[model samples]
Target: MSGAPIWIGAAHCVSALGEGPRFHLQRMRDGGTALRTVPGLTAKPMFAGLIPDELLPAGPRRIQRLLDRCLLELLDDLKPRPHERWLLVVATTKGDIAAMEQGDAAASALPLLGEHARQRCGFGAQPLVVSLACASGTAAFILACSAIEQDRYDHAIVIGADALSRFVLEGFASLYALDAVPCRPFDAHRAGTTLGEACAAVAISRDRDRIPEVIGRWVAGSIAHDANHISGPSRTGEGLLRAVQNALRIADLRASDIAAVNAHGTGTAYNDAMESIAFERCGLSDAPLSGYKGWFGHTLGAAGLLETIVAVQALREGTVLRTLGLSEPGVPGRVNAISADAAVPGRMLLKTSSGFGGCNAAVIIEAES
Candidate 1:
């Protein structure tokens, strides 16, 4: 199949590292992390990369307000053509759960998010919401690209947002996946993951001249289900390996063309081990790989896009940041847990992500001249 050119015009992110691409790049370069313990979260132990209370909106209406803030900033930066109709794709695993936990006022207010955007920003297009567990963000991007390729729309704005919630916190804690300290992905002493809350939006278009091109193209991506477990990944890494191979095949690229890999390292015993095995099976064991979960914790649905933005920035800057807390390899594979800056002048980057419900997705992005 011939690939359609989809340009990432602008990306805006708010995470533990900070806001915007520059803030995240600077923080990664400085090697700083902001994972902290959220007091009274639960007795099971938990760490979260939370947006500062001062920065978060007050009350149950906060998430919608915060999402609006981020989306508006992205739209302002792009200032897309006035005559063009945009397709807004919003992805989230936990949409305003915190607000719902607060009761009726918050629950009722959450669904109004889409209408709020249309009325407030005059988007003039209907918004679509996608909630496919943790893979929601990346899947949203794929959907946008497919829509454009099929001539469903000329442009699509993808936004991913999730707020911290006690329900999710307790659920993961019940699974014993909450780390007491900052997460250490692929480390010998790795425990589990930390939670994080943030919102990110990326504007993609067919107009290449208006976008900031990065190394590699988003040629192809796929989503698959293990169908074996609800929360646990398949032991053989079957689903993940298949997704990677399918993405590479669809892109008409080989594993050798991929210069680096942004792994879906959640620091859990099962996830880390499975991903390592998958990479080796996919013939990517020798490729330099790293995880951003340690830097921003696992932002759930927002993680895919947030990490994609990070990888794009790395390609643009020609340097890969060390995995923040990785120390001493643990998984039984050839996965390199290297620290320090590494120059990645290669032509392609293969980015992968996996989530609960046994869902996995991978996208190959290339730099454009």
Candidate 2:
């Protein structure tokens, strides 16, 4: 399986925007967002991106509910034939943290969360959970690609989810990272990120011919760490630059081949500036760029997969989405942040994410040309 191309058989994301990828895409096309004022885990009301009340599960196990809804829909929508060897990889930042706050002894553990998802989805084995902050979802893709290259499984399902919990909301508030209103990524007046929650998944396989549909081929990806700070990004954007450069080397592509860039734009002052410096250093300043944080806030663990699904759809549709909250470019570098949905002449997409602890990841996906 070394030279085999990993095919994305199916993709689905459940966010405040909608239940499926196409539905979410349509909502974006309509220029609508799910951001609104919601009661926080604390006493104050905070702006958040939440799944519609009508779509939420009625029972307990809040985090499990999101994963179950996503997987069940993927199973029904894709209808992939039963494969004997299938691997399940779950990406999450804080799993069942709310339960932990309520004194559930093992609720916050990764293994427990993985086991619950495995049982609900009826997978052959327990899931391998990735918890690398915001990079967890893209990191899962990197793992799946490697596993397929090593012939470890016939197919892999990577699901990323994080629900709005008391612990997480209060934690961000403590850091003073919340913006009072909707966040404006890459804007001159940008302040901070609005925390978001979502569950998203993609099915990939080495056997291209067996896939029900091919959204795109996973060409290459890489992750790097700058170790600059425990929670802050490198001032020079070193980690992201190396990650993008390494990914291009693996994919046999240059910066000019990329048609559009789906950035990890968290709308933070430092994070946005870091990305601007990175793209300029990597010679991608001219590439159209936008952040999805404005659309669904920062979905923490789900950001990578959630943004990838949206970017893939944009590539297929021959368009690039506007950075929702962008007004004037604030970064020092020549970052080409889009103000409206624009057309792209090429199908190649470079999607990147950065997270706490100086972690960075990037992946290249292209339309089936």
List residue ranges in candidate 1 displaced over 4 A.
Answer: 1-4, 40-45, 56-60, 105-111, 211-216
Off by over 4 Å in 2: 78-83
Instruction: Write model 1 residue lDDT over 1-369, tens digit each, in one string.
Output: 325687775788888667887788888888678788777766644688887766644444656755875777876766767688678888888776765676755564534666665555567777877778888888888888778877778778888888777888998888889777899888888889888888887877776765543223557788777777888988878888998999999788889898888888888888988889888999998788888888888998788888888877886777776887886888876776566668887757777888888998888877443
Query: TM-score of each candidate?
Result: 0.93, 0.96
> What residue pairs are clashing in model 2?
none
Give the per-residue Cα lDDT of candidate 2 at 221. Answer: 93
lDDT of each: 0.78, 0.86
Per-residue accuracy of model 2 over 1-369 as CA lDDT, tens digit each: 578778985787888877877888888889666888887556798888988766766567778888887888777755544556778888999988877888985767877877876776678666799999999999988888778878888788889999987688778888888888788888898888998889999888887766566788888999999878988899899999999999999889999999999999988888999999999999999999988888888998889999998888878889998999887889876789997999999999999999999999999998664
Give the distance in Å from residue 201's predicted Cα in candidate 1 to where it truly belongs: 1.2
Counting only residues 3 or more apart in sequence or on different chains, how many pairs clash (N, Cα, C under 3 Å) in candidate 1?
8
